[model samples]
Target: MSETKFKDIANQITSRIEQGIYAAGAKLPPHRELANELGTTPATVSKAYKLLAELGRVESFVGRGTFVRDKSALNQVIQPQHQELDFNFSILQPCLVLNLNALTEAYTQAAETLSPTLLAYADDSGHSAHRAAGAIWLQKHGLQSASSENVLLTNGAQHALSLLVETLTEPGDTIAVEALTYPGILAIANLAGREVVGVNLDDDGLCPKHLRKVIKQHSPKLVICIPSHQNPTGITMSVSRRQAIADVIKASSTYLVEDDIYAFLNNTPIPAISDLLPQQSIYITSLSKAVSPAMRCGYIKAPDALLPVLAAHIRANIWLASPINFAAATGLIEQGTAFELASAQLREAEYRQTVAADILKDFYETASGFHIWLKLPEHWRVDRLVEEAKKRAILVSHGGYFSVGDTPNCVRLSLMSISSRDRFEEGLIQFAELLASKPMPFSDFLN
Candidate 1:
């Protein structure tokens, strides 16, 4: 517990460097010399220097010694402004290692199909061709009643969900969501000026008991769920759970909004909960998962009656989804090219998950989606674990970023975004090493 220990000396050295006592680009004392001067082992001194070097605040030359690096450019690499809530599990994101050649070729072909005549205030719902293609896409996903009248293309699923929220409910109306749901959905609910409530879930998702309780208690106008492969938890609703949920919503007169973003990737296709309550369920799916995110084309299959309302919202908010983006997505799906592209990406994601699990099998469980959810060891809480990972120049998501109730001791590791498998695997190794490290009490070092 004394200040003379190697850890303490390391802290003192870091403090001195941060305070400009050791000028930028200046060399520090040799490991053995610092170890002797600080009254600690050379190994401990070396460990401290290694930590600083990894942070990019300092650099080391082989056969030479460690020296401070220029900190002026440190802000960009070490720190970012306006950090978004990131998770390790989102491999298919806004843009994740996009295949430029494939995307460019597809878009180029789609561009040729767009008529200059349709560019002006054309179909308020969506371009005729895009809607036709969107309907075909929906039918492949077990959406039986997806005619052009039932489908409305939007900028993205986010836009579709937003339109639904605004069109269906007024301000202060209650809307129920899965306890740990997508933050984007929550944002839409908030923007639409609705009261968002959480319905509890078991392993299979949204327990009927809790669903009924919340419905009876709040009498919410809408209940949103990701029935197949729920986000963050990756749990699918069983047939029985789905039936129970549909039954309760029918009895309670609560409408269901199914956000089936990742449903296409499901190995076993289950009937959309909408099948049971087609009159009341608003089914939304997107190509953001199956194709690439940049396509920004998603559609909603709502009750025929609500089509006008949704279209009105679309007209006011976004007039129409991008004709070019829609055509590109349509061409891929119609030509059986999207399925091929998605299959390859899914395989790559599966491989990454396997590699991550093999390296950190002792740490936690791996889920089906692109990322693995990990429970940190007893000493490493989510925040501290994140700090440890960052110290190694690796990035990961923390559990607190997802949970709303008692913050669980878990983290979602998105394996797909990184460019190289070897780099990601090495990062996973460093993560495991960080987890295996002992905690250093702040009080002991700060003194």
Candidate 2:
């Protein structure tokens, strides 16, 4: 371990981050692995990582590894609609164009009915009417047991996840998740100083056998899964598989957080995993994906026993989720317009999936709900492909960000972000070309 050399190592790593070779939220190589690559001792690499952490360039959790940090990563990965040039297949949101009229009408109706009571501080869970609306929304999707009394409100699914992670698990406790999962879940675990262990995923989603084995080995306090249109991978769990997983949870002492945000994207309603193990599941959903991200309306359907602590966390965090947003949400759900909007979005997704399938042809393999998990050619590494895509103003999500462990040679293309069908198709054609073409030397495209 060379003490003086660690500074140079830290600077070199910083340069890599700045150059986008090591993407934001990417897990850095293990100490010994990097040490071998750099021809240095593991101790020296650890010191360099520590220095980077102190400088706020990277973050290190207790049991989890180091990660590059950047606030703009979200904006960079999930671009806004105003950027017409960038073919952003990065943001996994519904096409905003489809919902504008309905959203405006809902909000306008909400404005007319706003009273002093609606504007005041709401209860911990939220206003009864809003909760009732969330219940209706959740029940329609899959969680038929949803009711106003058990639904808790939050800014969005992300907030609900954070709130639940805080309330249910302790720092340094192990949290099990799908091997390749939503980056947000990993982010929550890392920030909370909880250890994350990835269970292998199969075509049907999380492998029930592996999940049980991980639970036994790690003795995790919590397990989180995205049962519908899973992020990055786009694998929806089968109903029997969901029951198998629920049985795994039922046999274990751990609580399962079923993030079924994409449940609305399912053609036929598949009952939520939580529906099978009501006492052990925390189900979260939101209108953001189905309606508008600006709405910020989210719901958590928890067991009655966990309600008090979860609500207390909600109270401590933001007093309560604002009733103003929930007012619009309530109006939409009550009028039977929310389900209609979701159905329209689903149809749009179906059309987009066809467009993507036609353009990508053989390259398109994953079952898309709102995104395509296009496996890359062996010649094109995930990072290199992502970097090249960005160079062409064709932004795609790097597979590294979504991995709980190693990700396959793949990049996730969010099909719903780009507003124009023509622009969207053009981006896909370009991507298909990139996938077909072999990698060029770094010097070739530097200029």
Candidate 3:
């Protein structure tokens, strides 16, 4: 009847389940039988069963015996939820849900007018009309010289990044990025066998002095950055910083990859680094964040000389992005619906940012963006805070998820994932409460 005996029984059951002796949905032995087999009382066996259920390994039915739970279902049940306030990844839940009807209408109209030529294989750089539409979209983002000849259509910014990496650099070449840059770039670089050198970042963004040092030391062939409303930190580069960074890139052998995915989220106009170093920069933007990700539409503005290679790479990869999706995006852009949706989302984002600022005023500061980079107190570890937040059903990303080197003692809070402003405010309040509490002892988290 001792706690040790019950815990030992629980561990044995877990080991058996893991080793496939008890497959998912398989019923465990009756409590009396299990207790008799283990030389323990039925009460002790029940305690073990309770422990197993709590660990998400088993579930008990009212009239039937306890059964091992399927791993996927167990995960879903245990996955964090905050009485409906989940601050997980940066998904435009509100935007998508609220605009579904409008999107359907727009898509239906585009589909109705679809040319039969679109049904056939199109150009690797996308249909000429789509490319032209992309050019106009790029110009709206401040890339003044963007034109159909230089624009390459893509499934999304990530696809554009893959093409750029495949064409611009060889397997062993080095690429420089922000110290805490987008994890997607890191993943792509790692997969492509490219060495990534992390350049230090300051309040404004990629520090020019550190970038110069990285360029001198690593001789990277490319540098990817998100200048406007940079991911995770929501730090937008100032005009002066952009010019300084451009000057450094102009002096180096490194080509710049401007991931301006969040450009539309900005309420004010900011010049893309591409504007300063057009020939040396590849400007990428997509409607995934601004309009809808399901549209899968993105544009890449590169030098004319690189256009052929870029198209070839596109053909080599996925052949061409879905012409149908491109048509829908093109329709939205040409009709100005894309701009309207983006403007509405921008306003929503601004309002959310204000709500967050008001809630965490004393503890944190954030710019108007999809997420906030919260600096934790020195005493709190990022992982521990993340675990504690999960316990309270509030999901957040730890700094280590985006770190290129050593993880900072911080976490990123995404505001756009949760649709309800009141729910978001509630989650922030709960998050702040956790932040204000004293750190829990390490032993308290032990099984």
Q: lDDT for each of the candidates?
A: 0.72, 0.86, 0.80
Model 1: weakest 10-residue lDDT segment is 73-82
Highest-lDDT candidate: 2
Q: State each candidate's clash count.
A: 4, 0, 0
Candidate 3, residue 108: the lDDT equals 96
Instruction: Point out the higher-scoring one by lDDT: 1 or 3.
Output: 3
Query: What is the RMSD of candidate 2?
Result: 6.5
Residue lDDT tens for model 1, 1-447: 353454466568766875668865689999889888877778778777765554344689998888886433313212331233222332335224555566787899977766776556667577777787888877776677777767889878878778878888889999998877766666666556788778998988988899999999999999999887676777878888888999998898878998988766566567778888889899898888767777899989898888887788788877877777877888888788776766766677677767877889888674775666677889875645666566456666555435434446776666666666666677778778888887666433223
lDDT tens digits, residue span 1-447, model 3: 564787789879977875668865799999999989999899989888886675456899989999987542312322344355455533333356556676898789878987789888887578999999998888887788788888999988878888899899999999998988777787788778898788988899999999999999899999999998787678998889999999999998789999988888766668888989978999999988888777888899998778888999898888899998888888888889888888888888788889888888867875767778889987776656777887787877666556676556777777776766777788889988888888664334535
Q: What is the TM-score (0 to 1) of candidate 2?
A: 0.85
TM-score of each: 0.77, 0.85, 0.80
Return the candidate ranking by lDDT, descending. 2, 3, 1
Candidate 1, overall lDDT? 0.72
Off by over 4 Å in 1: 1-98, 443-447
Better of 2 and 3 by TM-score: 2
lDDT of 2 at 268: 88
Tell me the RMSD of model 3 versus the true structure.
8.9
**Candidate 2 per-residue lDDT over residues 360-432, each given as its tens digit:** 9868784768998888877887756877787788988877667665546778899988888888999999989
lDDT, candidate 3, equals 0.80
